[model samples]
Target: MKKIILIWFFMMFSMIFSETNSIYNTKIDMKRYPNASVVTLLDRESIIFNKDNSYIIKKHIIKRILNYKGKKASSEYKIKFDKRFEKVDIINAKTVKISKSGIKEIAVDKSKNIRIIDAPSDVGLMKYAAHKMEVIAFPAVNEGDIIDIEYTIKNNKKQKISGTVNFASREAVYNKVEIINIPKDMNFNITKFNWNTKMEYMDNIAKDRKIIKFSEKFMPQILDESNIPESLKFMPTVIFTNYNNWAEYRDELLGKFIKINKSKENLQILKEIKEKVLDKLITKDMTNMKKEEIIQDFIAKHIEIKYIDNLLDFEASSPKEILTRGYGTSLDIENLFLLLLKEEGISGEIVILGSDKLVWDDVKKGIDMNRFNYAISKVTIDNKDYFVDATNEFSKLGESVIENNIGLILDTGKPEFVNVKSIEKNITRIEKSYNIKIDLNGDALINKTIYFYGINAIGEREKYKYMTPIMKQQDYQKELGMISQNAYPISKQMDVELGSPVKISYTYKYTNFASIDGDFIYFDLPYRLDMLDLFENVRKYPFELVSDILRKNNISIEYPANYKVRIAPKSLEIKEKNMLIKRDLKIGNSNGGNKIILDTVVRYNSHIYTIEEYSKLYKILEKLNYPKNAKVLLEKE
Candidate 1:
C-alpha cells in the first residue's frame, strides 16, 4: 500500500507540468540558427524524488524539423532502462502541426510500432546495465513538422541516484530546462560541467518540497570539430548525485567487491594456478617480480576481455564463473586478478578509473561511476608500485595502455585514490637500427633491427598476432619502400612476447637510393625527419594525445672508399614546451670505407597541448623540415 502511494506521489509532481507554457508555443526565427537542421521548441526534464528513495525522471522535448536530415534524425528515438533497476514508460510521443484554426497532434501508438530490444549502454569503460530499450518511431515525420516526445524512467534503485543531463543538442535549441524536486531537507550535489549558466532554486515551493530549475535559451548545436579533448568540455551538462561524499561511494563498492572474493569454487581454481605457477618447490626461491610477471602474463595470454565499454553496466561475477565463461568484462577480469593475488599471498588491489582523460579534480565534482573506462591491477614489488592491465593481449607488465592521472584503488574496506603518474611517464619507445651498404651504383642492401618497448611492443605484437608470415613480409616490404621506390623486404624475423620487449629484424634492398650526377652523388637520409606534421593544423580545440612517443632512428651508410664527402646533412635540435626533436651525426671510417652515421630522436612529452603551444611547435617544425638539411653530397676522389 505504501509503495503505491509513493509511485502516485512521484508521478504527480513529475508529469503534471502544463504544455501550454509560452516556451512551448514560442516561434523561433529560423534565420538565427542557419546551421541547424532542426529547432528545439522545448526540451525539458523533470526529476521527482520520493520519500521512499524512488525517482521519476520525466523528459519532454519538442523539435521542429527544418530539413530531411532533421526528419530522419529525430524520427526514431530510444529510451533504455534496466529491469533490475528501473522501468520505462513513454508517456507521450506525437507530431504537432500548427494550423489556421487549431493545433493538430498525431500520436504514435506505443504498443504497436515500438521496437523493444535487449541492448546495453557502452559506458566508455565497459558495457553497463541499462539493458532493455524502447525505440519509438514517429509516423509520417515531415519537414516543418514538430516532434514532441515525453517519457519517464521510474527508478527504484534509489541508492544510485546519479546521472548527467546535457543541455546541448544535435540541433539548435531555443529553450532547455531541467527541474529537480526533492524533500525540503534533502541536499543533493549539483555540479555544472561546461555549463556557464545558473539555476534558480525555490527552497519553499511547497510545505515540504524544494524545487531547482535550470533554464537556458538559444543553445547552439553541437558540431563535429577536430582536436577536442572531450565533447563534455564543450557541451553544457549537469551531473547530480546524492552520495554525500566519496567515502560513502567507496563503502558501497567495497561491500560488493568483498562479496566477490568469498566463493570457494573460485578459490580452488586460484590455488591450482598458484601451485602450477609456483610449483610448491621450496628450491625455486620464488621472487616477488617473478610471481607478478607469471600471474599477469598467464591471465593476459589465457583470459580474453570482452570489449564491451564502461563501469556501471557490468556485474562482477564470481571467480569460477569468470573462468568458466572464458571471457569476462574488464572489471570482472581485473577482479579476478585481485582474487588471484590474495591466493598467491601477494598484496595487491584492483584499481578503477574513468578515462585517463579526467583526473580526480574534474571527477571529484560528483561521484559518478559512468565516467570510468578502465580497471587495472596494482602491486608493490621491490618497493616499487606496478600497475598491470591484462586487457591488452600484448601489453607488458607495468605498461598501461591508457593515459590517466588518477586511479581509485579498491582496498579492503578502504578505497583510496592513487596518482597514475608513473604509467603516464611510461614511454612507448621505438628504436630503429639501420645498416646500409651502397655500391658505386647508389643501390644499397639495408639490414634493420627495430626494438619496441612498453606500449609500442604491444602495438607491434597486436598488429601481427593474427597475420601469416607472408603477410608480415608484405607489410615489411611496404614499410621499407618508404625509403626508395623499388625497396622490398628480403627476410624478416620477429620474437613476440607480451610482457617483454618485441624485436623485429629484417633485410631489405633500396634501389637508386642516391641520385647520381656525372661525378657527384647526392643522397638524402632515408629517415622521416618530419614528425610535427601530425599536429600541423592546430585546430580550434586543444590537441589531445593518448600517450607519449619516443622514436630513435640510427642510420649508417657505407660508400666506396674512393668517394670523399662534399656535403654532410646538418644536425638539428628543435625543442618546445612539451616536445623534443634532435638529431646528431658521427662521421668516421668503417670497413675501409667512408661511413656517415646519423642518429635522430623525437619525443612528445605531454598528453594535451593548447593551440598556442602547437603553434610554437609548428614554427619549430618549419625550420627543421625545410631547407634540405638532410642532403649529403659525395664526390669521387
Candidate 2:
C-alpha cells in the first residue's frame, strides 16, 4: 500500500524520466560526451508546499560512470539539513555494474556505510543551528557503473519556501527536471540568475495550488577552472523569494532582530555592561574616532565569533547571552557592537553583504536574500559612514573583510542600497629589497628584507598564527632556498607590530649562485611576478583578481669589476587603465667598483576585469613577464 502511494505521489509531479526500468539499464551514447567524467541519466526535484506553509523536497538522481575519475566522483556524497527545522530521509540508494553482455548488482550494507554527523560540515549552511550531514558511500562503485540516490527533506515547521535551483551539475546532465507545487496564497517570486539558456517554462494554475515545471534536455558540465570567484552563482540558477520589496524585507528582518535583542532582563544587563565598558575604555574628552576604535577593538577582542553563511538562521542565542558567555555567532557579535554604539549616542545598523555585483544583478526587481550570506555593522559618526566588522580581530575600524565592498544597509528610517569603495588600502602593499655580493667562485651572500602592510600583513599573520617559533624559523630558512639549491640561511628576524608593517629580514649564503666558466657567467635574479595564464583565452565567466596590489622590487648586486655585463641594459615601462609596470635596470658604482641595480614597481589599479577588458589587460600583463629582464650574462673585460 505504501509503495502504491509513493508511486502515485511520484506520478502526481509529472516528471518525465524517459522510462528507465532500472538505473543500470539505461544505455547512453558515450561518444556524445567525450571529455565528461560521468553522465547523469536523470535528475529530478519536486518541491511540494503544504497548506500549513511547510514544504517537502523530493530529489532523485542517477549517474553512469565512464572511467576511473567518474567512479571516484560518484563513490561518495552527502546530504545536509538543519535538524531543528527540517528532517531528511534517504528513501533508497544502490550501485550496479552494467555491461553489454550482463548486469551485476553490488550488495553494500547501507547501515554500515552510512554515517550521520551533527556537526556543521558545510560553510554554506547555518553555523550555530542544529545543522547535520548524512554521508553515504558506494564502496562498490566502479568504472562503467550506475549509482542511484533518492531522498526527501521535509520541514518540521511551516515556513516560507526559499532556496536556489541550479540547472547544471559537475558532469554532463542528460535530463533535468524541476517541479514546484506552491500554495496559491503563498505567492513566492522567482528570480533567475546567469540564465543564458532559452527554455520554455510551464505554469499551471489550479483550484488551491499553482504548479510551475521546467525540464532541460542537455546540460554540459560546468568546468572547475582557476581564478573563478563565487563559482556556484555563475551557473544557470533560479532563486525564489517571498519578499519583493526591499523596504518591507528590511523591516521584517529588523523587527526580528529587535525582538531577539529586546528582553528586559537582557537589556538591563547590557546597560550595566555598557556603563562598565564606557568607564574603562572611554573618557569624556576623547575624540569620536578614538572612541570608535576603542569600542570596536573591545568587541573584536572580547567576543569569540563563529562565522555564518549568506542567509540568517535567526536561531542563535541573544546578544546578552553571548556577552556573558564570551562567545557568540557573527550576528550576536554584530548586534552587541550596534548596541554599544547606540549607548554612546552613535547610530549604527546591520547590513547584509553580497560577494560581488554579479550576485545582486536583480536588485532592481527583487533582492534574493540568499545571495547575501554575511552581515556587518555600519556606523555613522560626524556625518561620515564606517563599516565595522566585529568578527575579525585583524581589521580596524571602518575596515571590512569584504573583498568587493558591496551590501545593503538595513536602515529602518530610510532603507537603501549601499556600494562603498573600500577595496584598496594604502597599507596593503609589498616591498622587497635585496643586496647581493658575489665572490670569484660565483658564490653570493644575499641580504633581503621584506615589508608587508595592510591585507598583506593580515595574510602573514594568519600564515604564522598556528606556527611555532621553530616552525617559523625552519619555514623562513626553506624560503630563502628558492634562490639557489645550496642556499644556507645565516641570520633571520621577523617583527610584527600593531598598526605597522610586518618586517622580515634574512641573510643567506647562496652557493653557485651563477654559472662561471672563468670568462662568462649567467644567472637569473631573484624576483616575484604573478603569471597571467588563467585568462589566456576568452571566457564566458570573469577571471577574478580579488584585490588591488602594489609590488616593489629593488635588487643590488656587487660583482667582480673585471667582468662586464654582456647584455645591454634597458628600462621598460607600461601603463594601462587597470595596471602599471615599470622596470629599470642600469649599472651603477659602489665605492668606484661596479654594481648592478634593478628597481621594478608593479601596481594594479583595479581588482576585476571583464572578458573584453581581460583581453586588453592580457596584453598589458604579458609585457610584465620578468623572465627576459631577470636573465643576465656577464663576460670578462
Candidate 3:
C-alpha cells in the first residue's frame, strides 16, 4: 500500500509540471518571399515550485518575423533571456515544412515538449534551429520573464522576405526586451552607451516569478577626430556597466582613480596659482594695508568667471576668457578667483565643497568627496584664513555665500585642515512708527510710518518677490492688525528705499476706531491675542519654534476736559529667562475731555525649544492672558 501511494504522488507531480510547461503558441505569417530566411521563438514558461507541494506557473510566447532585403553590413546585437524560476530544459527540435502562406505551426505533447512542425523550407528550418540553440540561456529575471532576441543578416535577396513562427500555447505572457551589445566580429566605434535594467511587477508585492528585467542602450554616432576643434580637448570618457552589485562596482572604480589622479596634480596646480597671485597683489605701496581689504579688492576686481556645462573639460581659453564673459557658474567663478589670486602673488587655494542643499553633515556621517562640486578660494590675510565665494552678485567680501557655507570644504592644494569661521553674530533690525489722532465720532486720522534698517530688510524684500501683491498686502494688514485689530484704515500706500546694507521704510494712513458706551474705547489686537493656549497644546511635540519677537506700543486718546478717569486697569509685568511681557495704562484730564494712553511691550528670544522645555514655557505664558479692568466716568461741564 505504501509503494502504491508513493507512485501516485510521483505521477501527480509529473502531471502538474507537464500541464504548466505546455507552451502558448503564436504565428506571424508573411508569404511575399519564399527563399527569405526567418527565425522564430517557441514559448518560454516560468515554473515556481519549492521543495514542498505549493507551486506557481507563469509563461510567455512570441511568434513574429521581419522580412529583410539582403544587405551586407556588420552589426552588433545581443540576445537576453529571463530565468526567474528553477531549472528547466530548453529543447531544440527539427523544423518541418509548411504551406506557402508563410504560416508555420508548432505542436506540444502532453509532456510539454514543443516541436516546430512547419516552416517554409529546410534552410529556413536550419536557421530556426540555430536560433533556438543559440538563444536558450539563463536570463536574469526576478518578478517576471523576458527574452531579448537579436539577429544579423548576411546574404539573402529573393522575393520580399516574410515568414511566420509559432508558439504552441496561448497561456504565457510574452514581452520583447531590447537588445544592446556590440557583436564580437563588428569593428564599430562606440562613443558612449548606457545600459540599465527596469523591473516590472503586476502588483506592489513582489512574487518569486513576477519581476521582469529589461535593458536599454543609447548610442551616438562617432565624429572624426580631425573635425574636432582644438579648443575642446578635455572630454570625459564614461563607462557604464550592469552587474549584480552596482554600488560596489562604482566605489571600486572611484577608488582606483580618485587616489591616483586627484591628489598630486591637483595640489601642484593650486600651489603654483597661489604664489603667482600673492606676488601680484602685495606691493611696496600696499605694505601697510590690512589683509582683508587687500584680498577683497583683489577678488572683486581680478576674478572673472564664465559658466558653461557642468562637466569639466579642456578649453582653449583661460581666466581672461572668463573675465571677457560676464556670466559663469559657481565653479568657474571660483576657478577664476583662484587664478587671479595666484597672479597677484597671494597664497590662495581652491577648495571643493558641495552645495548646502545636497550635503547633510549628520546624514553623510563623515565628509564625502564625491558630493563636492563648487569651488571656493581660501586666502590667508594677516595670518588668518578666510574663505570667499565671490560668484554671487551682491555677496559681501570675504563672506561665503549661503549655499556654500555649511558643506564640507576640501583644500585641494595643502591638504591641511581649514575651519570656516562662524558669522551668525551679524543681525539686521527694522523699526517703524505711527502717529495719529481720533475725533469725536471714533474716526481716527493717522500717519503710519515703517523703517527697515538692516540686512534682514534686503532678505525680506527678496522674499517678497515670491508673494503676490494681494498676499503682501494681507501680510501688512495682519502685522498692523496685531497692533490694533479694530483700527481699520481707508487707503494704504507703501514706499521702498534702499540704503547701504539694506533699509526700507513705509508710511500710510489709518481711520475708523471703536468706542464703547460713548466714552470707553477698545480695539482688538490680533498680535496681542493670547497664544498661551495654543502653545501649551503643541508643547508636547518633539520640537518647538519660538519666533524672536519684540514689540512696543504707545496710544493716546483725546476727550473733553470735563471728563475724568473713573477706573484704571492694573499694570502688569512678567519676566522669565527668555520671555518678557509688560502693560501700562494711564488716564488724565485733557482740554477736550479725558485723555487715555496705553503702552505694552513683549519680547521673546528663544528660537527653538525641546519638548520638555516647551511644555514648561507654555504653562508660564498661559497665565498672562488674564483680563484687566478699565473704565472712565463723566463730570459736569
Candidate 4:
C-alpha cells in the first residue's frame, strides 16, 4: 500500500509543471538525422550590451532523446561562472516525456538537486576570483524524453574582450539563433567562418539600442573522424570584437607588458637579479649555447612553473614576488629569462603565436589575435634565429615547450608581426636495429636498439624520464607481446644528453616467437615501413605526416647450420613524390652457418600533400602493403 501511494504521489506531482511552454510546443523530425541518438532540437543565444558596457547573456537549449546514447544527454546539466565577473541564474528547466497515451512533464527542483561546486570556470587562471559551477541532475528521465534548459549569465565586469559564438557541434542541430543588442555608440566588427547553411540576418532600430539577429535551421552535424583536419577549421562560428586589426590587439598587450617594465623600482629589481645570475651562472669565456644551458637548467629547477590556464599568473605578480614564491607562470618565467638575457647583453623578444593547425590561415585573413595562445622567446646567435622556452623541466635549451614550430613574433618596438618558422629538419628521425637468434627448438633471443633524434628525442626522454624501472619494463613487454609471447627482458639501457639523440636498447627472450613446420622456420619482420597498413581508407582531405620523418632499420638473423635460404623477397627500391623507400636483404655465410641481413630506409621529404599527390601516394601504399616473407629450409645438404 505504501509503494502504491508513493507512485501515486509522483504521478500527481509531475502534473504540477505540466503547463505547456512555447519551446516544448515545437516538434522534432526524427527522420532528419536517423543515425543520431540525440538531436539538438533548439539552440538559442541572446546577448545585450548596455550603454554602460555591461553584458547580459541568456541561453536556451532543447534536446530530444531517441535512444540509449540520448539518455546520457538527459542525465544532468552544468553551468559555470566566474564569481568576480559574472552571475548565472537558471530561469527555467524541465523534462517532458511523450508517448502514444499522453505527455508527462517534470519540473526540476532547484532547491533540492542543484548544488554549487568549486571548479575551473574558464581557460584563464585568476585564482583571486573564485570560480564555481552549478550541476543539476534530472530525475526520472528515460529514453524518448525531451530536455529543456534555460539560463542567463550577466557580466558585472565589462572588459574590451571580443565575444565568439560557435553554432556548429558534433551533434545535429535543428535550429540555432543568436541575437545581439548594442548601443549605437559602440563599434564592433562581425566575422563569420565555415557557414554552410543559409543564415538570415536582420537589423532593427530600438528606442535606445540597435538590434542585430542571426538565425539558421537544419544545420548538419560536423563529423570528427580520424586523420581529418581540425573541427575548428570547418565548424561554423561568428565572432564580435571592438578591435579592428591585429596591430590594435598587439598594442594592447604591448602596453600592459611595457607598463610593468617601465617602473623604476621594477627595473632596479630586474637589474639586481640579472647581476646575481651573471655572477653565478655566466662566464666571459662561455659560448651562447653553454650560457643558455646553465640559465635554462637553473630556472627549470629553481622556479616552479604553473600553467593553470592560458593567462599566466606571472602577468600579475612582480618579478620579486615570483622569485620569493619560487613559483611562476609561463609568462612570468619567460619574462624573467628575457630580462636576464638583456642584462647578459643578448638581444631577444617574445614571439606570440597560435597552434600551427589553427593560426596561419587566420593570420593571413586579417589576423585573429585570439588565436595566439602561446608565447616563446626568439633570440639571434651568429645571425641565425632560434626559439626557446624554459617552462619545461625536461626540455633542452633552444627548444620550445609548446612544440608548435610555427607562429608570429611580436616585434615589440615596431608593433608588427613576423613569421617564425619551426625549422622542419629540427623535428624528426628514428633509427632502429634488431638482432635475432633462433634456436633449433623455436626459442629466440632478440636485441633491439632505437635512436631518436631532434623533437622525437625530446618527446621520448620526457615520456620515460619519470617512469620506474618496473613500469618501464612492463610497457616494453606490452609492445613486444604484440608480436610474440613470453617476452622476458634480459637487459635494458637508456642514454640521454642535451645535444645528442636519445638511445634506448633492450634484449628480450621469446619462448615461441618463431614457428617450425616440417623442415622450415618462419617469423614476421619487425617494424615494416608500410604506409598502406597505417591508412585503411582514403580520406576526403589529403593526409598529413610528421614533417621530415626519416627511419632506418637494420636486422640480422642467424639460423641452424643445417638450414638454408628457400624463399626470400628480392630487394626493391621505390621512390615517388616526396617519399623514398629502399630495402636490401642479403643471404651470406658466417662461421659455416646461414646468416640473413636486412637494411631498409624510409624517408618522407614533405610535411603536407595535395589530394592529387595523395592519390598517387595511396596507390603506392597499396603496393607496399603486400606481404613479403623469408622462409628458411632446415634440410641438411
> lDDT tens digits, residues 1-637, model 3?
9999999999999995464333212342233223322222333333232323123333333322232321111011112221222222333221222345542333223143332222222123221122211122222211112122212222111111111111111112133222222223322121221222332222112433223223211111122222121111122121112222223322332243244334665456545545666556566566422433455455555644433222121122234444445434455555556544544455655555542332233213322233344556676655656666655333343334432233343333223333343233322223344444545454555555444332344455455545776886787677667656655545463434433234333333344453545555453221242352243344323332222444555556554454455554557887877667787877765554566666767665523344566666666655544343333343323
Could you arrange the candidates by lDDT from highest to lowest?
2, 1, 4, 3
Error of 1 at 184 (Å): 2.3
- lDDT tens string, model 1, 557-582? 89888888899876778777678888
Ranking by TM-score: 1, 2, 4, 3
TM-score of 4: 0.82
Candidate 1 TM-score, C-alpha based? 0.85
lDDT of 2 by residue, 1-637 (tens): 9999999988965543425444447667767666788889888899998877688899998888888988877787688887777888888777867766776666546689888886554443333646788888976787878887888999866644356677766678888889889888876787766666465478898998899887777775666656765544556767676654566656655665666667887688678877877768788888777777788878877877766552445554676777777876666678778887777788887877764654444444545565655678887888877777866766655445555556778666766777643435533478999999888898989888888766676667567766888888778766865555688877754443445466777788899998898799878788746544454655766677755668899999998888888873368887788778888998977886678999988877545567787777765566555477567888998
Tally clashing residue pairs in candidate 1: 11
- Give the per-residue lDDT digits (tens) of candidate 4, residues 357-435: 4334643353455666566678766676777776665655544444443555555554545544334555567889989
Residue pairs in candidate 4 whose N, alpha carbon or C atoms collide under 3 angstroms: none
RMSD of 4: 7.3
Q: How high is the lDDT of residue 443 in model 1? A: 86
